[model samples]
Target: MLSFARAEGAMGAFSASGTLAVMLDRNAAVILVNEPAERLFGRDLWVTGRHLACADKNATDALRRAFHVLLRNPTPPAMLNPVPLPRLGGRPLLAYPTRLPRITTKAHPVR
Candidate 1:
């Protein structure tokens, strides 16, 4: 049962081709990403070691707020507004962020 559960969980993460799972550090830096996430963020793999803030100020701000909220409750998925990614040839993407426990700060009540 455990083995089946583990496999199912792993498969779930890769179930969607264009979907992404982004891991952010405390300083708002990209820590880890799956292959699909790399394509989704587009060219961001080149800037992986840098702060997400350097990519796009507007997106950075939005990400910060969403990160904070996620750290607090770690529930209720947040939808990141669609934005034009110029580095990716001005392609539009809607990033839906889910707050995972390890990537978040201390847990708090959701308001």
Candidate 2:
């Protein structure tokens, strides 16, 4: 499995890979994108704050539903295959929704 010490590191790795990669937050908003992904999607604009569903209205409803399910139950990653990319000649693509590790906080008692 691919691992990154930080989100920036992950983005750097993704940018280096030839395959398209995208990282989304629990809210389904894009958090990271790579060069291949930008070329595949044919846009140079910033996508970090944009929701994936905004690209294709036909899949918006279903994508939102899947996002909700993933948020509710995030133990195992969710996969969405054959996703239609209307902007890319309606080409099908695969998407994975994985949960990011949470940071724990604990109060320490002073002696």
Candidate 3:
């Protein structure tokens, strides 16, 4: 498993592997997003002012719930159950959230 000892390493690996990864803050605002994910913007997904969103109400609800799953659950979920991305054509991509370890930024240290 890739570690976020440094965000660069994990983000780089995800980019190299062609995996779409979005790092979200407690408020569901995006902190970072991979290249593959950028393609999703203005299509199925939207990142307005650092907050990720979708056009479909159901999809948006699912996405929000998925994020909360990570926040509320003591144990990490094996998967976010693969929520489907909206599509105009082709198979929809599945979106899932993975919790990062409580990484302490220089400004905030973990106890």
lDDT by residue for model 1 (1-111), tens: 554354345435754654556555555566555666566544542454464432566765675676666555446455444433334455445555554434224557999
- Give a tens-digit lDDT track for model 3, residues 28-84: 778778888888787667887776777676877787888888877778675668777
lDDT of the candidates, in the order given: 0.52, 0.57, 0.75
Q: Considering TM-score, where higher is better, how would the candidates rank from best to worst?
A: 3, 2, 1
- Comparing 1 with 2 on lDDT, the higher-scoring candidate is 2
RMSD of 2: 5.3
10 residues in a row with least lDDT, candidate 2: 40-49
TM-score of each: 0.50, 0.58, 0.76
Error of 2 at 100 (Å): 5.3
Which stretch of 10 consecutive residues in model 3 shows the poorest summed lDDT?
1-10
Q: What is the Å distance of residue 30 in model 3 from its true position?
A: 0.3
Best by TM-score: 3
Question: How does residue 60 of candidate 3 score in lDDT?
Answer: 74
